[model samples]
Target: MTLSSSDSASLPAERLGGLLQSASFHPQQTIALGISDLAEQAKEDRADKLGISCAEEVGSVYAAILGAIVHRDAGLAD
Candidate 1:
């Protein structure tokens, strides 16, 4: 997803770092939180998780997002 100035300002890495410094936290929790945060940022920017921008670029954006998601899921043969 495209990041806006406001959203990018916080940067998930910084948030992850803060969470990591906490002793009681776990990696899964961090990943979940980061994903959630990324999703929120994506929502704000009107871009999909795969960084497709349908509003500005039209159909290609949706196609790109879908293709990327599928490709990632498909990956290499096991």
Candidate 2:
């Protein structure tokens, strides 16, 4: 199951992290899909936390790692 963009953006870091971890433990395709969904959600709206900057930073790192993996598999990674 995938989360809606607004829903994802509003999710707490712990919740999002848990979902991401769950996706990572699944098949590679599932991980890619999860990251893709999160990326789009991030673009639309960032999570509103007490430490917004920290949340965004952590989210970006997750995106970067997942994106790198996807790009590498697609022969697009440098």
Local distance difference test, per candidate?
A: 0.64, 0.74
Our tally of clashes for model 2 stands at 0
TM-score of each: 0.35, 0.33
Best by TM-score: 1
TM-score, model 1 to reference: 0.35
Q: Residue 26 in model 1: shift from native, Å?
A: 1.3
Q: Taking the tens digit of each residue's C-alpha lDDT, what string does model 1 give over 17-54? A: 66556525565666567678778887877655345543
RMSD of 1: 17.2
Q: Write one digit per residue (lDDT tens) for candidate 2, span 1-78.
A: 566788678766775777767775774666566568768878667554436889889999999999999999999878
Give one clash count per candidate, in the order shown.
Answer: 1, 0
For model 2, the run of ten residues with the poorest summed lDDT: 42-51
Residue 25 in model 2: lDDT: 71
* Model 2 CA deviation exceeding 4 Å by range: 1-50
